[model samples]
Target: MTASLVSEPLDIASIRADFPILQKILPEGQPLVYLDNAATAQKPRAVIDKLVEVFEGYNANANRAAHTLAAMIDLELDAARSKVAALLNARSTDEVIFTPGTTAGLNMLAWGWARKFLKPGDELVISLMEHHANFVPWQQAALATGATLKFFPLTPDGRLDLDRLSETITPQTRLVALTAMSNVLGTINPIAAIAARVREVGAVFVVDGAQSVPHGPVDVQNPDIDFLVFSAHKIYGPTGVGVLYGKESRLRELEPSIFGGNMIRSVRVDGSEWADLPARFEAGTPAIAEAIALGTAIDYVQAIGLDRIAAHERMLTERAYAGLSEIDGLRILGPAVAHRGAILAFTVEGVHPRDLGELLDQQRGIAIRVGHHCAMPLHESLGLASSARASFAVYNTRDEADALVNGVARAVKSLRRKRS
Candidate 1:
């Protein structure tokens, strides 16, 4: 299969060369193979340099300052917002509101909308595949509003159990929150389909696009979604920067999560009011430096081409599935879901997942994630304590995949042969 298709020059070798960490050799003399992209991707030199430049050269508060340095920082911040909007195919930059990260964004949405829309009889539907970032905010919101939280089950094949959803989503459903991709199982959900169904029930659709945005193309316009949240760090950008995309109309109905500073327009001794849709959402001084770095990161990825990135990871995923399957007592939990983004989680028999992870680290200099991956509900559903996960990015090559395969196999064998 590798020979059948022309392996286009991903130029990731050159890209990897740009990352200083990639060049370092361990004291044990092993090369690093980063397979933990889903957890957090390594920042490129450009992003790092940009962060330094902003923090050192033009360090200033955005939106609150009138000086030259402050104006420069504000310009950079606005540019970052534009880049985020462009990435999501948003009509204008105003739809994009910056946050600390996806978790913060989700929390903001839940806080703002729950009280305004949810009531005692209302329902909030989420897929069983949701990561805790997507699931917990609404879950708590439902609790606060006395609204019911319902989870749609997954298909036997590990995809969303959409067939059962028609029955699950009733007239009282106020919101449907779903993950765009399964971080643990590597299942890419049919969010557009789910969005359509949610709209039919007169419910608002809130998408956790944290995984989906980094993997490939995502257009908020296409889904007609009410709200979308994603983290910049996962997409090879800086930490402390995230995006919250809300439909303009829906933004009007929601109240501000935090009440202070820039978000307000009028304040009396007794009462106050908010600014506009997007501004009202951003309460305090945002992550200025990180946002600028995120802009640069977005530019880098877009120039590299997300489609090509997706295709490269697709090849790697296929190779990973086949190679890892040969290991004894290892089990893949998700759909042998072929059309997934490059995130795979598996459980190893007769060995602790944490032990396997440590072995891969110490013996092979490979970084693979272990645990429920923050989705405790899904792991418990399958009766698993934890699992091993390897998520890929565009910079990963066939050699890295080969290293991962060998690393995993070696770890399992070593663990099983250990004397009691």
Candidate 2:
């Protein structure tokens, strides 16, 4: 269903019941306020139960045996792939390849495609907002292949300057890799416009959707993306499972950099032919239980409805920005509330982020992320050594936003007094 079609507001209390950890009280006897969703989300009972079900029953290698358990595993594996394909609105199940995580998928692309296609004097365009997962692979690929790596400079407000798109991407550009949303800045990039420019220049467009996929709907066919990658753990699923959605033609052309038993059509003494589409890239025995449980996570989100989840988190972000703006020394890192995700990255004057994070956790039972958050270059570009981030999800409440504001204000007062 569309975003506009979400008729009723989400019942958060009922939703929180699905995740038992929400009821947890910290060792300090304070209730937990989990705001570190961008790092990883806590799993629901549905996902946990799904994992147990998969492991307890029919736990066997998929796609190679005639036994009952093996056949069951094969069917479950196919169903999991189909679920992931539906989540991304990919063209077909063949487009989705399972990897260990988003890092693995992007690394696979870097090794498989960049190594094969990129050459001397070619340009690889990226942005200052990319997480290291998307950044380092291309950077290393350029270093290895003698290609030049160009960056799209950020606007004054920390969003990608789309005006620089034309200047950055040229005919010589072989690939344009960017994050759909910045994990640090919480800025959502314009995918259609950027993808169009990349297409016009005949460059392969790859998206790091690790931050975006869990927040909202992603339609691959509509934007004509060559490849998009995201991790399951970020969306209330198990860790160690990721998805790489590549266009059918792109997957057909990409050489499998990983080699093992399940990926080959026939193995001879000489070189062997590879399997088709996804199996070509997914080498070895995959994460069967994790992948199956990931499908359950997808189902959990769908049942709650992505549009509803987005709206709920948007409300939470609005409350957070409004409350945090009232603090005297605090400065938010990204654009005004309208263009950001549920993340609020900020720094308080005279207060180190690590110190502030400790205060929030130890004294207030608030869980936030501190440090560069895996986007050190972005932080450096913004003239910040580090920052604290509080990201929201569907089950988060408005009261928790108030608690964060109160806790930070109190922490800042105590910290400044100690300095005095």
Candidate 2 accuracy as lDDT: 0.92
Candidate 1, 305-405: lDDT as tens digits: 77777888898999988899898888887887474779889988888989989988888888899998999989888888689999998888898998888
- Cα lDDT computed for each candidate against the true fold: 0.86, 0.92
Off by over 4 Å in 1: 1-7
Q: Least accurate stretch of 10 residues (summed lDDT) in model 1?
A: 1-10
Error of 1 at 222 (Å): 0.5
> Which prediction has the highest lDDT against the true structure?
2
Cα deviation in Å at residue 79, candidate 2? Answer: 0.9
Q: Per-residue alpha-carbon lDDT of model 2 for 165-266, expressed as tens digits?
A: 888888999999999999989999989999999999999999999999999888998888999999999999999998999999998878898999889999
What's each prediction's TM-score? 0.96, 0.98
The lowest-lDDT stretch of 10 consecutive residues in candidate 2 is 1-10
